[model samples]
Target: MTDPCGACGARGCEELFHGLLALDHSRAEPWGPLHGVSVSCFLLQHPARLPADGGAAARGLLRAYLDGGLPAVDRLIGRARAANSHRVTGRSAPGGAVPPGREAPRGGFAVTVEEVAQDGTFPAAGFPDRVRAWAAATLEVWGPVSP
Candidate 1:
């Protein structure tokens, strides 16, 4: 088998991803608002899986959700979709480079998919709470986004 993911140290990321997808489809209601959170956290951890624009967008979306809840996240997503851009506004400066002040941490996040999975498998009771905590903790490691 392949080694664990370098970023998140997940042993079986593909399986985890599949589980996440199942949870997303099976528990859409509770998972809807928090889906972005989970996605952002995963993308941020596995930065190589994302391009520069995607990384910035993930950071921006996660920050917005932390600061303004669902409405803020929705607004950012709406704007990106409307503009046909893959970035979250204010997350990337021009040309898809992450702004200096908003860069991800040099090492890694304190929390990751492992922690989220610690609560149990996806679609299990209280899984949403684990994801919420993972998002919050991961964002905490990234610190506050600069304006």
Candidate 2:
């Protein structure tokens, strides 16, 4: 029940989406950290969800990565923090600090950026390449993809 291209994993497609991929609420990565975030905006404005709630979730997610161990590989915190900052406040968090009350589950902290610019562009420079490297490492563990 692996992916047809062998990129996702040995698990079934349904399993990957429905059961797994919860982004580890525990933040204790006994296995490892995720490769990279899939850059896309989700509609959290539905009746069941609200923007404020979504903001909280964003901070929580950021906490996981900032405190997680998988980042020991490449530490893509600059871009990750920026992404989190913009998500939480619609403004930049200069230090990439996870918002108050949302502490990272792990003891480690994110690699802080010297400064954050308000140029309106989301990710910092070289983010896409970092994403690729993360993906490459992930795919290597999952197995090769087909042409």
Candidate 3:
């Protein structure tokens, strides 16, 4: 069936994809639904499922935009790199391998800032509003949200 909200729409989704692409494996996984729209974070975390570099870059930008800069952005980046990040993965049901097209659920990416850290402050200045504006722009480019 066609995606009810055209979940596969190519516009804003591209931005989202890019956002995912740029994310190093260290960021928080907000892999769940936010108001019915799914942010496919879990998919991006799997080595086999990671999007291409270009896509990853876009996703990185989106992620950076969303999560806000950490108090120590450079330090976090260093830690993540030094750790030699691992692709996140999870096993399927007992004795069940992951299905080809149905790996992780679709709703695991779109995290809010609070969910990503204990410190309740933004990284870059003027962040939260910027993210909101970015998301709104994406939604506008994609189409209006469904009721």
Q: Which scores greater on lDDT, model 2 or model 3?
A: 3
Best by TM-score: 1
In model 3, what lDDT does residue 145 have? 20
For model 1, the run of ten residues with the poorest summed lDDT: 88-97
RMSD of each: 4.5, 17.4, 13.8
lDDT of 3 at 60: 38
RMSD of 3: 13.8
Model 2, residue 135: distance off in Å is: 4.5
Regions of model 1 farther than 4 Å from truth: 1-4, 85-107
Q: Score every model by TM-score.
A: 0.72, 0.25, 0.25
Model 1 Cα lDDT, one tens digit per residue, 1-147? 657777777666667866776677664766655777788788767666766464667777777776777788888888777666565354332123244656545435566676677633665567667776777776666655555
Model 3 compared with the native: what TM-score?
A: 0.25
Off by over 4 Å in 2: 1-11, 35-69, 72-74, 83-147
Among residues 3 or more apart in sequence or in different chains, the pairs in candidate 2 whose N, CA or C atoms overlap within 3 Å are none
Which 10-residue window of candidate 3 scores lowest in summed lDDT? Answer: 31-40
Point to the candidate with the largest lDDT: 1
